[model samples]
Target: MAVQDSPPVPPNVATTGGKLTGSLGVGSIVFMVVAAAAPLTVISGTVPLGIAAGNGAAFPATYVVCTAILLLFAVGFTSMARHVPGAGAFYTYVERGLGRPVGLGTAFLALLSYTAVQGAVFGYIGAAVNDFVVSHGGPSVPWWVWSVGALAVVGVLGYRHIELSGKVLGILLVCEVGIVIVVDVAVMVQGGDAGMSTAMLSPGEFLSGAPGIAMIFALAGYIGFEATAIFRDEARDPARTIPRATYLSLVLIGGFYTISSWSVVSAWGDEGAITAATDNPEGMVVDTAARYVGAFTGDLVQVLLITSLFAALLSFHNVLSRYIFSLGNTAVLPKQCGRSHPKHSSPHVASVVQVATAGLLIGVSALAGLDPVTEVFAWFAGVSTVGIVALMLMTSVAVLVFFRRSRVDDRLWNTVIAPAAGLVGLAVMLYMTAANLPLLVGGSSTLAAVITVVLVATFLVGVALAVVRPPATVVEVTTQEEKK
Candidate 1:
């Protein structure tokens, strides 16, 4: 039976009343995406955890494996970038390939995932800043105070202009990356405790002892790189910029993670690294800095960790705002959120909503006297990881089906084979995430199940919305006629 083709929408349709204005080239986009990953923050916080609880010295290899899978995912991901240039990104791609209901559901999932993760950062950053100040004999306020203030600052940037956010992220990202690189270089020059052996990258190390956990942490680090397509409206020559940025960001993120992690393992001697991490997971990197470089540099890295979290928060705010704007433009959300700043050409309304939503959550957590890192950050970050992995799996399949149905490209690897490969890897990761749900979200089975149910229910709500109030017109890839 021949599949009937859906009518394609006009190419480059301005769904939002006002288009986002920016000339963000590859470098700008890379900074935005990688900043969301927050290198120094991840190394100082997440890496030690991975080393201690995950695969030990082999943790560095997990990043390489994750990177390889994502690179496969990106093969079809970047291919679809040329076909669907909408800011909706996964939503647009899935809707065009699958259907409106699924697309709408994916959008809901995307919003929940990005917002949750962004909110998670606030919890951690607030705590970090509060500790920094109190330990330094400064005024002591509740962590939520810092979280709310940081939210306000990012809210302003997100509401203003893409270039402003880009420049801000650029400066923060450089400092964060530079500081980590300095530590890495220092470790290398000293030849580490184990004399700089390549054993960390060995196959035995990579395959040994619960590598799945390490891979989860590694995958979380690379989450924001996929947002490259979400900025299509503001990209300069998106067809070229998006693909280049996608690959560039992936490579840079992967290489940086691999090297930094390996250096850390070497710093303590690959054998003792796991013990060092286990002993003091939080301050392993800082302590290593003090020992390897100098006490001053160690203090500097601690300070940079706060800025790293801030950079990540701002980057995520931009992404979540765009997601809200895309839904609003499609009438899935309030029309007000669809409006952009006339002068700044940014998603001001959605940005405001982002800030308001985050503030409300912070207020609730504060009132409840919840631990920001354990209760707020852990739960949201875990759920977001699950949601994102699911989205990636859907997107990989969407790429394959879309290309097959449209027959727009005759190439096999770009459309079919690579996506198939990517889907398999993503599915495995999704399964691993679900299996480790309790561990990911504070080790409470009941809590994990509740969060899982919420994720499922969020998608169902989106599906119901699509059925109850259908879009006046469904958006799809441009047909030959529409393109012309």
Candidate 2:
């Protein structure tokens, strides 16, 4: 069987036309990727929900498990990154390994997932902003107002050079991580409520409650880490930078979630943690901070929570814009969408489109009288989780098939064993995500079924589009010179 690869770039094309450019090093890329994971938001919002509704004290262990699985996925992912090129990370890889139609379908799905998550964050940040202002005796403002305001700011940043967004994200990431680390240290010094028990790490504890639910929530926190490759066009020395950033992101996100969640558990005592989480899921993290650190830290956490969501919004905006630019450059969409701003060397057209789409989603949700946090945030976020995990599963299979057929990088672990293992893990995660869609989307089985149908239809539409109007050939840059 013949193997497929993306078409190479023509020698005559100029750098400022269709290509994106930046001076992003490993640290900058890592900041963008990790910031998208939104550490503070996950620690405060998702952690309590995982504990109360998931496996109670053992929730932290779920992050450990998720991190290990994603690291396995990264082995083949980064290996392919060195050889396969383009901003269409998952889409490009799938096209290279599979054929164009399936790859195009994956592309559409990727767009949907990233767009959904970005909208979800918009809803969340709006609510965060509204709450902070009203609680401080400011005028009562609607959440959508704040969301739209954020959309404008993100749009402006995304339409500029990539380094600007990277720098901004780096600052926000440091502040959020710093606050969480402060609380973690305080918990350690004070010896926790139950004297720092490690029972959460026990296998038996992992299975105590709704472990499936716990797994899904934990997995959600790691959403944006895989986006490291999407910045390949902007990174300096991408072959080395992409892989290093990928590994560093996974390690940092995993370690932070695991240790911080454990501290939350310890602050309340194993038994008390579950009760507190159940009673006040929203206030669980904030109150824990107040108790362990100080009331001042708790207030600061609240403020930083909004910034954390803003960082995530900016990161996903950049990711989605690049995806659009890639598809456009390949003739999957209008050629103009692929064009970069000559002055900024950024994907200006695609960035504008992304911002417009998000704004439209927010507008429609508001017009329909939907609750920004519950309906918009929870529902869309659930859809994104399901969509992205499905993509990862597909990408893992593509990696295995690509390596086996092409005889490229024939090392057993990178080419075969790791992708296979990651495939199984991701497949399980997809199953859990799909099965618990009702719980994820606020317990409407009918709504969950609707989400599933919509996703399947979106993918089929992409496949049909590819068949009817095939994408133009795209450039594929390889790490090594061809063997004679």
Q: Cα lDDT of all candidates, in order?
A: 0.86, 0.89
Which structure among the candidates has the greatest TM-score? Answer: 2
Q: Give the TM-score of candidate 2.
A: 0.96
How well does each candidate superpose onto the true structure, as a TM-score?
A: 0.95, 0.96
- lDDT minimum window of 10 residues, candidate 2: 475-484
**Model 2 Cα lDDT, one tens digit per residue, 1-484:** 2222373343323542888888789999999999999999999999999999999999999999999999999999999876776668998898888877888889999999998999899989999999999889999788999999999999999999999999999999999999999999999999999788686779999998999999999998999898999998888878889999999999999999999999999999999999999999889889999998888876798999999999999999999999998887777888788889999999999999998999899999889888888888999999999999999998998899889898969699999999999999999999999999999988999999999998988888888988998455444444321221
- Tens-digit per-residue lDDT, 384-405, candidate 1: 9999999998888889989989
Cα displacement (Å) at residue 57, model 2: 0.3
In model 2, pairs of residues that clash are none
Q: Where does candidate 1 clash, by residue pair?
A: none
